[model samples]
Target: SQKIEQNSEALNIQEGKTATLTCNYTNYSPAYLQWYRQDPGRGPVFLLLIRENEKEKRKERLKVTFDTTLKQSLFHITASQPADSATYLCALVSGLYGGATNKLIFGTGTLLAVQP
Candidate 1:
């Protein structure tokens, strides 16, 4: 079966720095990859998405890179701040079973805490 993997531990960072998050998967090749940010007691907000043919994508201080060959995705936040701290999750379309409907399979997510 296909599986998505992410760092189970929380990440701590100082203000005005960069925070990098990793997401890995196995037994599948996804066409699209998405990243989302979730704050405590709230729903996740969409961050970015990268297609399999795209190498890198960015928006403001956020950047995402997808490597289909390696079956991995990296999420980055530059000039991080306290407000930017949240749990980040990576999701991909489960093309294996739900090819027609394209169900999204999300990773467990990694928590990020930025100190002021």
Candidate 2:
């Protein structure tokens, strides 16, 4: 069985510091890993995607590292701020598209609270 878990508690940090979050999983052979950001009731917005063969990926102030050996992923937000406060989700891309779109399985999420 495949399972994913993210820190459910809110992470409080200073505006200029880095915010790090963890994602753990068990029993899943996922094709690719993805990260998304969700604000309140809004749907998740894609952040970064890293294939199984890739060790790390980054965009702007965000960085993600995937360790298949550990079955875990880490997300980092540099220069955090109140505007960066939101819930971050880690997902596993599962199933073949059969030439169509792939399906993604998302974890609960970790709420980050960045202080100004």
Candidate 3:
């Protein structure tokens, strides 16, 4: 089994501020890391993906960075709002070089609460 660590407590942020979350894994190496947003009672929605070879990737209002050396990934959301309040998860495919045979493992997830 794969285990990744995220913030055990919910992160509270003010509206229009930038919220950053961290994911760290101690066991396995991943070819890529992905970020997702999940609302209560809803499936996770894909947000970003950063490969091991890539340093960073960004989407509107969101940015993700992957650091293979540190076995960590950081997710950032700028100008965050109440709508951005949700559980953010980090995931990766467990295999050498992320082949199709690899299974995806998701981190425990960190909840972000944006206050307006």
Highest TM-score: give the candidate number.
1
C-alpha lDDT of residue 56 in model 2: 88
Model 2: which ten-residue window has the lowest total lDDT?
93-102
Badly placed stretches (over 4 Å) of model 1 are: 96-100
| Clash tally, candidates in order | 0, 0, 0
Candidate 3: tens digits of C-alpha lDDT, residues 1-116:
55788997999999999999999988877888899899999999988989899999999999999999998999999999999999999999877663568677888899999999
Clashing pairs in 2: none
Per-candidate TM-score against the hidden true structure? 0.94, 0.93, 0.93
The best candidate by lDDT is 1
lDDT of 1: 0.93
Evaluated against the true structure, the overall lDDT of model 3 is 0.91
Query: By TM-score, how accurate is candidate 3?
Result: 0.93
Candidate 2 per-residue lDDT over residues 1-116, each given as its tens digit: 67899988889999999999999999987767999999998999999998889998889999999999999999999988899999999999777646476778899999999988
Which of 1 and 3 is ahead in TM-score?
A: 1
Cα RMSDs of all predictions?
1.7, 1.4, 1.5
Q: Write down the lDDT of every candidate, Cα atoms only.
A: 0.93, 0.91, 0.91
Ten contiguous residues with the weakest lDDT in model 1: 94-103
Question: Counting only residues 3 or more apart in sequence or on different chains, how many pairs clash (N, Cα, C under 3 Å) in candidate 2?
Answer: 0
